[model samples]
Target: MEKSPDAFRTISEAAEELDVPQHVLRFWETRFSQIKPMKRAGGRRYYRPADVELLKGIRSLLYREGYTIRGVQKILKEDGASYVAGVGRGEIEPRKREGEMASAPPPGMSKPAPRVKGAKGEAAPAAEAPAQPLLPLGEVRVVVNRLSENHADMLRAALRDLGDARRILDPSQGR
Candidate 1:
């Protein structure tokens, strides 16, 4: 018999659902304080639906999105578990890394910078926050692809500039 979607899952079941090893789940619990599976006798683990969702998000960030453990941890700390769970459900998009700028803003549209709480409780400038709405996976993919293309263009331009500078410095080495 199959359990309902809302049912709590054992470690094995959760691991299978997440397509990760049981040991990986255990290791995640150590790295991410947000993952608190209920403990039964002999330390058997049962994962609540939310816990599983959070784990799925962490896995997506680490594996699919290529985020370092520290990056995921920082996301969880700033955005909270619910936000990560949204990411797992494909309801929220991961933010871009530094230096991955979009080529240009759409006409007649501009995004204000996100703000964070300052040391004295005032709103201060922060790179990622409410500046952008949580986007679905399709939109996120579109944005990511555009960023990647633009980043490649930027790198090519930078390389060209470097080559020109090198030629100016050493005419004998010019290509």
Candidate 2:
């Protein structure tokens, strides 16, 4: 029988659910003070629902979103555990909306900048957070498909700008 997702998960269970290796989870525990899984008599780990969620968020930021370990650490430190948890829970969609991005990219692919500022000097958030971050073009395609009738021309321009920005940032890029 399958256990409920809400049930506490073991180290293997949490690692499998997060799609990361067990050692990766162990490494993350060392780096992230927030992930405190319960330990039994033999020091076996049993991850709580909340702990798993936090791992999800951290993995997204590090593996998918191209954030450095230190960067994720700063986000957690500045925003607090709840904010990171929100990110993991898909509540803080800060880039292209869910279902718009791809699941993963080839090894050489690079992620685009997720946040930018507005014309008025206000910090503009990215389109929405990436729900399935994979490659840059996937998100551009999303912007294209979602262009409202009234905003078609403007969205086209925006897409063009995105393309240029992506070209400039590609890690393998050569002028």
**Which candidate wins on TM-score?**
1
Instruction: Tell me the deviation in Å of residue 169 in model 1.
Output: 30
Name the TM-score of candidate 1.
0.57
TM-score of each: 0.57, 0.55
Per-residue accuracy of model 2 over 81-155 as CA lDDT, tens digit each: 777778888898533223223333423474653445567777666675346555545345544343346456655
Tens digits of per-residue lDDT for model 1, 1-175:
9999999999999999999999999999999999999999999999999999999899888876767799889999999999999999899998754444434442234455344566778876565334656443223223223244766577666666665666688757654
With a 3 Å backbone cut-off (N, CA, C), the pairs that clash in candidate 2 are 93-129, 94-128, 94-129, 95-128, 95-129, 96-128
Model 2 TM-score, 2 decimals: 0.55
Task: Mark the regions of model 1 whose C-alpha exceeds 4 Å error after superposition.
Answer: 99-175
Candidate 2 deviant stretches above 4 angstroms: 95-175
